[model samples]
Target: MTINPLEYSAASHPGLMRDNNEDCFLSQPEHGLWLVADGMGGHEAGEVASAIVRDTIERETHENPAISLLDTIQHAHATILKSAAQGIGAPGMGSTVVALKSNSESYQVAWVGDSRAYLWTPSREGGRLERLSTDHSYVQMLVETGVIRAEDAEFHPEKNIITQCLGMQELPQVRVDFVEHQWHKDQWILLCSDGLTDEVNDKTIAQILFESNNCLAAVDQLLHAALTGGGRDNITLQIIESPLRDNPLRKGLWQWVPYLTGKTLVDAWIFGAALASLVSILFYVMYF
Candidate 1:
């Protein structure tokens, strides 16, 4: 017998008062994975880093859905380094990643840096949202040791100072969690960058999702609330829907981009193939 697919929903918010928004998201049912990346750097470098993370995740695992999560994330890290090597000052750019992989009743999460995933359940106080991913931030360390209250951690001036991120270091240590045993019927998973948590409170977020008709509307309402509350960064979100035999494109469209555009395709192949050859060395020395 075939098992039923699990429900999914997610949202991100950009907080009040910041210039360059640097967040990215992806949701694909074939792979049964979702991700969010929060990037940091000077100029538009933050965006570049975030896009690299998103692109790597989309490209690597989407092709072979049976691979292990650690292997996919490692591939993504390598790709990020390769992308950074193409730029002069990209060494300083980096991003934080949070990912979820689900199969029917159970889900596994992997994270590095400070982006978070939370699971919400019913409570006597009208339901509580439990933070599933721990922040790799300076403030988090302080809070963990009883040096500060959870409430104080929220208002701490150095709360945004995260200790880990993708592309910042050569090999980031990732924390993987198997949230296997605690599955619930109506629980919702929230994946977000710090921007949303920095602005609106958790209770409000829960209310919005609980009252909304569907996942899409829930995301829309979150964006609206964030903007109203004060949007300081770039915001991105994806709502995962149950897997269906909607299209064979689940595995096809992902790799077809190169073949679709002849000129672009030719250019990519030429670049990809020419690199690690005599031509790339000469080009790099002369121009780059």
Candidate 2:
């Protein structure tokens, strides 16, 4: 089967415990690219670095679709390094990036740092979630070496400590991984920051996506799961739903979920509080 044009949705939130949203995302359905980035450094610096990365990817990829995705990411990496060198960005500023790019029949996923991409598809037993990116982080190393179980890595104190990312001068060699998968109907792609995984487990995420009516509701449910489970960091995600080659789902530009209705009053209250928190944090990031 040929690859279908994708229908997509997205959501972002600062979560309850963070004072700023240091995450940024990009959606370019027309060009078949989407991204999620999580930044590190001080609050101000992290936000700036993430935005720079996001904007660079959007600009570079759109200008030349034939340019290699890895080359485009390297351009973003070089941009961040240049900004840091010139003092335009903060010292130690860096970001974790995960992106999905597609052609007419297959998709390529690439990542650096701990942000992730997952694929879900229906099966006779049940729908399944398959993580597409391996993290460049210390805890992940432990899991790889059998020093700890995969499940135990989540509870490890150093789970958030990544081994490599963009914008660090000492680490001249950063590793980026690329994977390719054939597209099919009833398949979904999820790109997200660690914030969502930190709060919601993989099983729960799979269940939510399987149960939801559409990609929009799945994104909402995922965000809700993260916020309600102690949103300790900025949360961001993009969902891409693949349709049949002959029939595609057409959607307008994605909007934040604040206007969604019909949930329990308590669910609405929780979402409202989470959104209010995000707005306040954004202002703090902007002005302070």
Candidate 3:
């Protein structure tokens, strides 16, 4: 059977401290594109920077369906720079972006600054949460150079200091880091601003995502977690479920298999035992 249309959910929230949310996200399954942009500057300027990034990508992808994702992001970078130069937002308005684009068989993730992308596979499929993008921040640099442990970088005072982003007047062009992966039926992609990472640890994030019944639930839990964790910055995120179809037998079997205390492995074992018992009964009845 063919894969179904991609499933996705996105949200942006002004945290407990921030009165205004400067973060923005896009979910365009039609164009196979989704992204999160975190704005920086001050007040309205940050909002403008992120909004420009969102609008530019939305418009470009809608107008030119075949445009390269990289070229589209570059176009957004140029637009943001032009807007800042023309005094549209503020003198130093800029934004960090992380985006995902996909085709039928494969997908690509690209980013600048600390906004991140992660891949999650189910336990039955060698479950794990893998970070797909690296941060362009001073702390990240320090971590890379052995100045600090990766775990320590999270709480470091310089963690928020990003090295580059869209619309920086000092740089003529921004570099976008990217990676590609073959699509798998059991994989899910998550894109988020540092707002989520700053408040929630990777281990907690993986737990929430893996335990969630669907993308919407995962988004809700993640947002709630960040807000509870102090919500120091604007929180934004998107979760994209792969389009590939699950095994037909497993999908049908799950319909009658009740969750056993939210433990997937235990529930799976129960399902297998029940199936085997049913098969043995049918064989006995038919033969005797």
Per-candidate RMSD vs. true structure? Answer: 21.8, 15.0, 4.4
Stretches of candidate 1 exceeding 4 Å from the true structure: 1-20, 122-125, 170-182, 239-288
Count of backbone collisions in candidate 2: 0
Clashing pairs for predicted structure model 2, backbone only:
none
lDDT (Cα atoms) of all candidates against the true structure: 0.69, 0.85, 0.90
Best by TM-score: 3
lDDT of 2 by residue, 1-288 (tens): 345568899999999988789999999988889999998898789988888889898898878888778877777788888898899769889998999998666889998899999999854345789999999999999999999999898899999999888776676656778999888766899999999999999999999987886899999999999999999999999998775432323211112234445444545577879989999999999999
How many clashes does each candidate structure show, in the order listed? 6, 0, 0
| Tens digit per residue, CA lDDT, model 1, 59-80 | 8787777777666666666666
TM-score of each: 0.73, 0.83, 0.88
* Models sorted by lDDT, best on top: 3, 2, 1
Residue lDDT tens for model 3, 29-93: 98999999999998999999999999998899999988888888888889998897787999889
